[model samples]
Target: MKVYLWVDKDIPNVYGQVAVRAGSIDEPADFTGLAHYLEHMLFKGTQEIGALDWAKEKPMYEQIIKLYDEKAKLRDPKKDKAKRDELTKKINELSVASSKISKGSEFPTLIQAAGGTGLNAYTNFDQTVYHNSFPAYQMENWLKLYYDHFQRPVFREFQAEMENV
Candidate 1:
């Protein structure tokens, strides 16, 4: 990770950005939009940051991924409409259950509560960037949040987040 800082006495807030080299270009051709989907998931928070019960949520989260994998394997959506619909229903059911135990918006909520603004992320062909502005004194807090943000992202609320992407 690389860091850059710009300080100005007149500005009351600190604007921070963390950009990673991976983006759409890094995604596998078969999985186009994977990078953009990841950008959205990263905000969903990590194992330590978002889960009310990681032990329970983990299994459901895994099941959701498996269902998606299974759904993806159905080469003919129209022909396999019945099977695809079943998988979609299962995915949605587990997603809602998993969400109950997950802190879906805790990451952004924490930032907003701390006087942070412009909290958002974006992905392009070459890179993805997460950024926000916060009171200068909260620099340490911002660093800690982001440090945990990048570690072990849980992918909770996968279905709802997928809609956003």
Candidate 2:
């Protein structure tokens, strides 16, 4: 709740933002881009937004990760192209299967529906920020949205987002 406000009567809308003091500088050497990855994942959706039935999706997700690990171990491109391609195909199929039951992009859609503008986030050396602009009267709605957004965001679509990164 560390909100810093700059009030000006000339403007009809308010620019609100949230930032966490964790970024690349805070990431471990072995996981250099984890923080930035997390920043990107934040928009993918929370548990309530982008999610499938956990009871069924969990086991498949685990199997996909295991397959990816196995593929990584055989990293010689020229020597393992066929095997790698097979593993990749399997991963993609599993991902699509999992996604079939999940819902995503709900958060941004909510903001947009509320007339929010500039809905986005970014990660830099020392911080990760999520920000948006809304009409002055929507402050209460904004607070609630922020609360739900950060409470427990589910890392949905990990493989796709990782590929994007």
Q: In terms of lDDT, which candidate is strongest?
A: 1
| Cα RMSD, each candidate | 2.2, 3.8
Lowest-scoring 10 consecutive residues by lDDT in candidate 1?
156-165
Q: Residue by residue across 19-62, what tens digits does model 1's lDDT show? A: 99999999998989999999998888888787899999999988
Summed over model 1, clashes come to 0
Candidate 1 residue spans exceeding 4 A from truth: 5-12
45-121: candidate 2 lDDT, tens digit per residue: 66565665767776776788898799979969999999999998998898788787766577888898788999988
User: Any residue pairs clashing in model 1, and if so which?
Assistant: none
Per model, how many backbone clashes are there? 0, 0
lDDT of 2 at 87: 93
